[model samples]
Target: MSDRRMSNAITRPRRGMALEVVLLMLVMFSVIVLAGLSAVTTISRTSNADYHGARATYAAEGGADDVMSQLDAAMQDGIISGEDLANIQSPVVSGYRMTQATRTTGVPVSRTITSGPFSGLYSLNQPIDIEVTARDTSGNRATAVLSVNAQTIPLFQFGVFYEGDLEIHPGATMNFAGWVHTNGNLYLSSDDVRFQSNLTTPDSVFWQRKDSNNRLYGVHINNAAGTAVALRFDSRSLSDPLFKTRSQQDFDGRLMSRAHGVKPLKLPLPSNTPAVTLVEPRVAGDNSMVQDVKMAWKADWHITLDASVFTAYTAADSNTMKANFCTFLTQERSAGLALPSAAMCARIFKPRLDAFYEGREDNRVGSTLAIIRPDLIDIHLDTLRLWSDSAPAARAPRIIYINVINDNVADTRRDFVAVRLRQGAQLPRSRVAADTGGLTIATARPVYVLGNFNTIVWRPAAIIADAITFLSQPPNPNMDARTSWPSATRCTGSSAGWCDVNQQAADMNTARSTNVNAAILAGHSATPNDFMRVGGSQPYGGGLENFPRFLENWSGATHHYTGSLVSMFTSRYALGLWGSGVGGQYYSPPTRQWSFDVNFRFPERLPPGTPSVGTVLQTAFRPLY
Candidate 1:
């Protein structure tokens, strides 16, 4: 009985030990499972925080991009100023909050760009530093900074700016003393051409044959020697020593001596529309916009004035005559004698007209409204002949505005109106205190300046036209027998062979020295090849060297000219190709004395219809904290 009781006690102790081991194992397993779960939760929370931070960074960058786009648009619209940029409001995107700050200083920061077509020392406006901060829902924050440098481009600053190819190869010794730039290729070939300024192009600069031939008719620099001379200049040097002698070769080896191959650049003018403005002379104390007239035209019309009109003005009181003429025009319009179109009517202020005709002797500045249909009127320079009986030197300026007409008119072959400036004719004038503002003739039509324009005085003047041409002599005065008529066979001989009647007649007149001292904004000749072509036994039309065509024999005379030449659109009538080896046929190449008037350097002396170029450059960008 004692043994059995002891065995039962041992069995009970063993059972209790097994139960304790199981309980300990279960507690250890539970602790390990809890630790694993805690570790997974910690890793998940850390990843979520990182994701929010990345999102915040993206949001900040997006906000910066948005600001840049908005600023660019505003700058292009011609409304962005330092004041406007300073007042930009911060934008909120998605669930992120964005805060922005802008800093602007009036001082301009100068930078030299070395990579693009605009590579030059640019005096950019003060840097505008924009700092943007974005915060996400979980307190994740990111910050970005951007720097914007806006540049105001003065159009007159450039000696020449072309939207298309610029070809300049004068046979005579010519010196261009201003910065020349082109959006297209630059073709230069001359024996003694000196560019005293910088020549830049977005496209390649070619000195080889314009045709597909291997010719040494390339460009020459200071070295008067042949093509083997070593070019001697650096990339930004005043002298360009690069020449593409071979057609198939690249601009490497010796040709890249003093030149820089640059990237393309955007034109400074407005992209949507040509930047054109009509500015009236600022009177002494007139500070309002009312005095500045913004001129616009729509259709076509012709105006004529007889010697009797000026005679009538000379006899009657000037003011009373002007008032009476205005009254007459009003009455006529009411009676349907003249159409009530913008081109037909004009706001004639006697003070302005009197100021224009102040120094003249005839004082024939009268308010006469003459409007005739395009089909009924003769569009020639002689049609504007002032009364020969009147004082020759006392002629007053004549200003007219033509409206836009239907281009699809069946009978009208020319898309633009023709303004012919006859020889020995005087342009209108606007009088200032000491300096005189010369005639400002503007039209949507193509203007042909016959000979010796603005030759009498060195007055500030401008001609704004769709296209401009300088005829050595006058065009055919016959209205019905004009050269531009498609059906006319003047170019086609009576029996055989194509003959240019205008060219033939122009060859007969004597070429005279042309003196033009005015600003010209004309259209670019799209068919420059045709306009500059030299063919036939008497290939007379001298190339661009003689842009103002000469018909007379100007063997020993010099073409003295001073003005700014700006081309904006494709030419409508002056499309003729310029050629080589045709000297003294059409016009004798003059000792070219062309220069950009220094007066244009001043803002006050800028001619009317001048456009502006916007150059916004980026300096630096980085993250803020």
Candidate 2:
């Protein structure tokens, strides 16, 4: 009976142990399944966040490219207005959202730039900055920023043709207001072509007077003799202290001449052609930001230049070259100053591509003003028309003269660009330099030196033969029209093949360089530049030839008389000039030309008049403690 009881107890305990082992196995399986599911969920959430973040970054980059494209388009159109800014739209890309903000020039901004030429600040003012931020539903975000600068200049004009070589055959007459540019030479018969002046110059519409404060604001000229000259208004006339002058209000009227024979009023120098003079006026201004409002002044350096004193070494000739004066400006501001203050634009001491037109790098002084260094030079010559000799003077040919002006700081204490001429070129630069030597030259500006290069060849038969070939070439090339002519002992042709154009071009290149290092140093107390205009028509200038479009409507008003369209074109040349008084009326000078500093203030909780809000979480949970 005892043996049977022991067996029953052992069997019962074994069965209970087996039941506990099965329960433990079931619990372990449940825990393993739950861990696998939790790992999958975490991976899915991380992958979604990464995908959205990538899309946001791409969207921000897209915004920056869109803004750049818009700016380029505006440059081509030549018109960037407030409407353009209003039409800007935000960018939307796949799986992301983006926003953009832009700041354009010509608006009432609070920044100013008061260095170099204030008038040119307008041209350099076409700079814009953009910032973009992007976010997506996945709570991913990205941001980017970009800045750009651009300029608009008309490279091509309508109805203008750079015909291969223009030749005015002896005794031929052609009249048109157009410019002719050639890489050749210019020739004229004995008193064959005479330049005609427009009737409406110096009229009543535009005029201004120069003053000591605005000495640098006046007419500037560039000549092939490698000289830069300035023509200033009578400074004493504009300082009446009577009226506060606006940029547009201070100007001269245009002058008109109905008859061709009536000569324009000429102002003779105080002495019988005095020596040339050089004046270093203390020009001052502020150009820190494009739209800053601050007054510029040039005190203690306003003095007169007696040309007789400086022209002692200058030679005279008619073959000296000339070019249209140019300035850089913005849509709302005019950079028409002649010898502006030091503060008008940034004073660069080295030759950098961003600040100036680079020339030969080694010869440059690398001073405060990055002196213009031109590696390649261009020259234009109008064709000479030799018509049938009916009456020599009866047939008139139009000639356009372009000048290249450069300021050599090496001759700081003196004036004149010593251009060493070739031994025997038919065109004589010395003769042209004679009349121009007494002209006033700004430090680095260009002035128009208009005149003819005349020659008389005794080889009667050779001249006659060349004339025939030139006259018979056909005016339109497709048309076979020929004109009759009179016989003379000499003949003339303004053809590139006639003179050594390359030699002349080389001489000009050499004259433009400077060996002096300190001539371009900025004045410590110079003032900023005021508003002005550039490029005017002159009889000797290839007036109708080079600038017929400008001359046709020019009434000889202050330089800006042609409107903004003309102003934009002239502001890019190497040197450009603007004169006061048109048609006898006077434009007054701006007594209060000012530029202010750019005040950038970060948000200290933002200004009071401004409301600010940004992204935040949707809600919060409040639990009882």
Candidate 3:
């Protein structure tokens, strides 16, 4: 009985110990499970925060992109107009909150660019930052910043800049010494044509002629060492597989087009807006957007015709109208202008005209071409006209804006249509550099420049016209065409509309090799320009070598021209075909002695009212959260 009682006591104690051990293990397991659950919850919360942060970051970046696009649009419209700034709104990203985009381009700075394609060129630049903040509902936020710059660059940077398809098919040995760029395709054809500098285009570069499939030899472009090398193939002509290898074989990247990833050079105008408006005189009813860019708005003297009466107005209104152009010239001679007398002015410009002419336009017979010459009204602001920001006024005119408004279109002759610049060798203002804004003639009409111009003194001079025709240099006895022309030079005074056509042709035929030193910004005649495309063989528009219209047969002489040549638009009023002459045939090609004047690269030397191209470039990007 004693042994059985001792065994039961021991078993009870062991059972109690076993119960305590099981309870301790259960408590430890519960604690471990709770700790694991807490860890899992914390990890999940961290993951959610990470996801929200990434979303916010993405939204911020997207908003930044949206701002960039808006800025690009603003560049097209001259940057930051009242309406343009309003268009920059934050983007909508799903599940992300966006803050209103903001931009700041402090003060604009003007300086010479020291690198890149525009190296050594001066430009006005405004650097600004675009910032956008984005947030997620989970309390995560991110901010993105994009650095950008807007640049206003002078237009004459290119030696030759064409807005449309450019064709250089010179028949003679030609050397072009400046940078050449075209917004359209480039047709490099014919033999012995050498481009001395870089050639770029936003379109394709062809090795064939614009008029036919004929591809002559001896067409070369510049290499890095400034040597002319044969440009055999490019992205268009070379094998697609070897384009990267072959294109860099010779030119050293100097010759490039869109196929090589060249972007289009843009102007600061609305989409599809014509750049020709920069030269056209602003009319009374022009839109507000065009006012700031139009060079004619700054005309020192305004000339217009009304009721068969012509007037050179000092201001926009008739109250500021000077006098009858005929009487005014005679009076101006006493005022030290040395203008033509009243009778001479009337006889030179005004005449009875046939209602219409029988000559064809664009080479069509019986087309009844509008009589184009009698409408050549002209003016001589041949005196010192000092101009100031305030009413200091112009002592002599440096800028003349001429607009011919006939309103007599019903008469079929299209009267008062063109302006000619004569006696301009010694323009009104002294030819010196003081930022005095040199001689600039702005007109939208087809302009005729008679005799050697701006050559004698040659201080920054420019002619902006729809089409510029360099008339044969008049015979000079050391004189001015307006005040001192002999009877044989040009039809003047009472010989106006009745000028002998045969005699005029004789004068043009006798044109001597002349020198014209001025920058010419004018229109070019367009052709079908569809050679080797869907259709083939379009009529060529005289090519770039003959861009300055000639009217003589100089078998042994050269037309010495030195300046920048820019063609911005197709001829509007002067619709005559380039090949067709004044009386069926006008001129034989002269030895083209043309070169780009390097002086234009200087900012102080740029002609007054020089139009510039606006561009946008992204500088940097960063993300903050």
Candidate 4:
């Protein structure tokens, strides 16, 4: 109105136009604010997801460590009894609750103990599976799983039977409530076990004794001055007449008669058996006194044993108290009888084939030594040490069956020195070279024949022990080999030939030319050029990709290879268990350690009316206007 004089300049602004401009500016400002908010929200959500994932992974790892500790305890204390497992079912730590479960595959428990009762390589096989699941109140959870295999000693099956020099190591102990026989010198170090022959007592079951406090303990052997060489025991219960009240010398006479095919003179016993004594009856002024052994099985039981004094049991006189005692112990135990005295147990294991009982010919090796009944696969080196150290301890070739636990031999590999041979074979040099011979593992009972002169020699179908040992050392990694990857140099040190990886993709051609490729392809499988994953047997990781570091070929090419990339995290050997296919051909970031597991379901199609939690969908892109 003030400029009402037709001033075209101040037209007072059109009302509708002003309103439209205001709205447009407001819309632009709103769009900018919304975009900023979305970016911030995305970043926050991503960070939270990463944090939770990390936490879950750590929790799972903690669970694994706990399970390992439990296993260690069981091993140190012998077999893991049912009671031990019960403890695992509900383990509590700090404020978290842990639950555990077990599952077994392959063979059952009973067959293992009964497989080859009379075979030297008979195996009492049993495998155990352990799974631990942990959860906290804060909606956090973790799981860990493990498996262990144990082979029990058949010491209970066939009483003690030995032929050579029996050396009970300083810490060794033998607890038997059955008859024992030996034809060799029995040397006892520290006292830790007891030998009894009385099935009448529930404590008759074989029990090893330990003398925590220094106590005078040991077996009282009554043998000739220097003619003993083996130890034997009765497998049957202690009540057999042969094991009753015979004197140590009388037992020795019976053993000689049995080994030479001569009839044993029956000895009379007192109508009223006096309180049986554990010491070998001593003849006044005789040089051959019973050698004393300390007891390791600290049981408060009373049964009597008459032992010889001389450390050796090799007296030549046919009627010498020492000789009679040694022979008696040997023959009676083999026949499930007893040597009333140490003399009868001496010289029981003569090499004469005619001296062996029928069907027991296979049981008897060279001299008077008879194989322990209940064929057992020689698994633990320590068990071998115990028996081999005993009288007539012949480490005859026997099939040793074992389940493959881990592949990479190096994981649990240690140089085993001093390998004693059994009757018919020659002993190898003391030291068993690493990565040289194949390590046998038994899956099923001693079903398949492994070796004849030896017990068994079955090889696994998928993974072979030979392969595991062979690959233990660095394979021919093409050190001089050149590769094309992001930014990297050639490998340094003994592990050369492959490229020194530094965030890059290596060419497949370089991989095919290296020794690593040669070794892998040697396995008779398609070769993936980009990576080298390696792990196969027990004690070692599994699969190809599970290997610590490897090369991967993302690009689809016929024959391409990549440089070496170390995981800096996993076991020495790479494992390819995860991912698709038998050999993990696909590659991903290296795993620093054992981590959380991700579950996948079958049938790619989703159920009707269900929203996908974390999945990708393909659709046309559209702009919102």
Candidate 5:
């Protein structure tokens, strides 16, 4: 019995030991669970912070875009003045707030990097730097920087800007300075020609004819007088090292130190149909009936001619003279007034015309006239007196716009208006003029500048025409007019002595240099078929080399000229043919001394009809963190 009691006591002690071991394991498990929970909580908080930072970065980008948009809008609206940088606030987006500040400066002038198609440093205003700061609700922040440039493009800044192909294949030595750009391909050929300025184009530059089996002609650099034949390029490759190199050892294909390709430059027109616009004028017409008056509203002066006078002259005139005289005018009378005939409508509504002219004064002398058609209007600079030294601004006409036909007419021919300067007429003078504002003459029709226009004064002037032609001195100096007119049977045909003396002046002095100073915007002959060909066999339009169409022989003479030549459309009439030697068929080539007018560089000296070219370019961008 004693041994059994001792065994029971040992068993009870063993049970107590087991319970203590269990309690220790429970405490360790609780410690491990609590540590795991703490780690998970920390990770959740870090993830939220990172997500907020990313959101802040996106907000900053949006803020920068908003700031730039506002700045562009302000500039376009003319709200931003010079030296007027200001702070701007951006609208809150998705609980993010943004603030912006702008600063502008003039671009530093660089002589070496003078001008180019894509270079904005020549603009009057320099770069605009914008700073944008974006903040989140949790105080996380991000920032962005952007740079913008606004430019006012002057058309005359370029020596030549053509919407179509530019062909510089001069037979004689030619020197051109200033920026040159073309939307179409550039064709450079000739024996001795120098381009002293930057040249650019969206299309390829060809040293040879792409259609003529790649025929290469040579070109020179910076030799205006053609005395030296330095720096010549005959390579037809655009990737040729010569195109990018400026060293004298290597051919300078670009002529200038810096030359590169650029995106297409867009120039907006005032109208889509007419493609041009000028100062306001009065007109009365419909599809069938149209009446146009020239300077009729002006109180200064008036000139008129009667249809009866023309008919009487036609009765005793040659068939050719009668047909040319009444080309646009009708012989029939309507409601006691001369009405434009159906033939006139058909001719005017045609796509184009060979030429059109209207005399400033009434050549008939005694006949009173009253009818004017939209297709034909007289450009009487002598009578209208566009130039005057003492004329008041109100008295003088600044912009002259002629609408050849009413806008209602859908026919392209109805849109045609021909402005022919009186043969051998001289443009009015601007000598000692108080008002220095320039003059702009714009027309939708082809314009023929008879002879010696704007030669007396170096006044600021521009001509915007569909096609421009310069008729040489008449074949017969004794003829009454450069244009054909009805011959008079009797010596004293009319009381006004209109037929007594031929209006055509004696041929211009071939020895004396002919000076033409103005900005000329005309059309180009696209296909060979569109070229102005001679009327007879062996037709040969002078090509783009003779862009200024001529009719008289100009052999052994020099033509001195200074102006900007711009072609923006296809030529409506091809250039006339030419032949070699003195008194040859058509006209002879003259020594061309053409130079860009430096006065055009200044905004104040720009012509009245200059078009504004605007572009907003992003110069730089950055992210701040």
Candidate 6:
């Protein structure tokens, strides 16, 4: 009985010890589980915080992007408007809140692009530095800074810029010495053409003609050694990848095409309208988008004809003609007209209504036609210059717009509707650049140049017209050498407006080796495949060689021309086809002694009221907070 009791006591004590040990282990395990749970919770909270912080930073960047977009929109008017400024605010993102948005400057200033594609060109630039702060719903915050530049680049700065397809196929050895760019496709085919500067375009570059003649010729650009190197592979000949590789390696990255990643040089106009509207008059129902850019609307001196009397009416007339025959573009003619005397009116710019001859335009008997109103708007630059001095206080005329309005047009007798600039040996000084600026004459009418023009003093000048014709002063009894060019104070043909060389009939056989210096922005006809099929064997309009229309036999004569040539549209009026110069068709081609004037590279040398194409560049960006 004693042994049995001892065993029971021992067993009971052992059971109690085991139970105590089991309870202690459960307590330790609970402590370990709680610690692990705390660690996991902390990690989860840290990751969420980091993710929200990143989201806030992106939101701030988004706000900054919106500010950039606003800055760009501000450039539509060529300046920042009060409304444009008000529109620049921090955008509301779906889950983020904008804390702040600000800009350093919104005013525009005249400046030159220091870098990028259009460096060395002057423009009106507005620099903006923007900062934005935003926070996500989690209260994370971020800030970003962005710097942008909006620039309005003047078109004259380009040695050659075409808003449409530009084709050049000169038969002779040609050297184009200037930066050349096109907003459209470019076709180059020639015996020998050397581009002395960078050639850029957003479109493709073909080695053949525009009408698909497929006549490949020696087209060249400069290499590092300044030697002419031929461009061999075209878009058709090779694949895109290979062509880009070869052009960049071979041309030293000078020949920029779509394959080489060339971006379009934007024309600062609406996307809906054609670029030619820049030089035309505002017509009824015409899209209003282009009026602000038109040369007619921008002219400081606009002249028009009314009834039988020639009256002047510009608000600036007291400054230009000193109350002579001139009128405001919007002023009515019947209200006590301030017209130039008959003699002076007939001297400056006079409209002729008579019969005349032009070799290219025709269908009438022997190509003769009646001169309708403004069939010929004659401008005597010398006469205007000397006469305008009558009012020295008058501001220098930067741009001159002249067109004709006739009450009758039922004649249908083909005639040359043109504006001629003659006796321009010494042009009037401009009011810009300390009264030493140059002149720019714009008209939707065809432009004709009788004899030498802008050959002296060499001020900056340009002619924006429908078609440009050069009436050479062939060696004649009236004028001897090139030096004997008509004096600024003198003229040929009759002194009367109707009979002077400015308005008389022209002969294709009369031409001399002439030298003219001015930038030419005009139009030319296209040579589509249809042109060859319908016209047969003959090329459409004299390629780039005769872009400046020739009306004389330039067989052995050399036409020395120094200027930029930009053909932006198909000819709307001077619809004459190219002549082989073999059988007498229109006019013979001149031995073109042409060069791009380097003087235009200077801002001071640019013609007054020079128009610009605009762009907004994202210069820099960073995190400000």
The alpha-carbon root-mean-square deviation between model 2 and the true structure, to one decimal in Å, is 26.8
lDDT by residue for model 1 over 1-625, one digit each (tens)?
6999989988998999999999999999999998988988988898987888888888888888777766665565333465567757786799998998866646764444433335443433545677889997778999988887665444555566565666665677776555566656665656666654456664555552232222234244322122333223222233343332321132223222224443223323233543332222123453222222222321112232221222245543355554443322311111122332322222221101111110111111122321111111112222222221133233323234332233333322222224445433444343233434444555655555545555654555666666565544223323222233232223332321112233333232333445666667655543233222332233222323444333334555456666666554455433433332122133445567676666665555655434544444556678766
Q: Write the per-residue lDDT of candidate 2 for residues 530-550, one digit (tens) a residue.
A: 123233322121111222111
Better of 4 and 6 by TM-score: 6
- Flag regions of model 3 displaced more than 4 Å: 1-45, 114-120, 235-249, 259-273, 306-374, 378-393, 407-416, 430-433, 475-510, 581-585
Instruction: Report the Cα lDDT for candidate 5.
Output: 0.49
Candidate with top lDDT is 6
Task: Identify the runs in model 2 with alpha carbons over 4 angstroms from their true place.
Answer: 1-4, 77-87, 94-96, 104-127, 137-139, 151-625
Kindly indicate the candidate among 2 and 4 with the higher lDDT: 4
How many clashes show up per model?
21, 146, 9, 148, 7, 15
Q: Could you tell me which residue pairs clash in candidate 3?
A: 347-494, 348-493, 384-395, 384-396, 385-395, 385-396, 386-394, 386-395, 386-396
lDDT digits (tens) for residues 171-272 of candidate 5: 777777656777666666677667766566756665644224333345654433323344334323434455555323343334322234344444432113
Which 10-residue window in model 5 sums to the lowest lDDT?
A: 286-295
What are the per-residue Cα lDDT tens digits for candidate 4 across 215-319?
Answer: 234533333343332323321223334433232343333222122221111001111221111111222432211111001011111112222211123442224
What lDDT score goes with residue 397 in model 2? 14
Assess each prediction's global lDDT (C-alpha) against the native. 0.46, 0.24, 0.65, 0.26, 0.49, 0.66
Identify the leading candidate in terms of TM-score.
3
- How far residue 37's Cα lies from its native spot in candidate 2, in Å, is 0.6
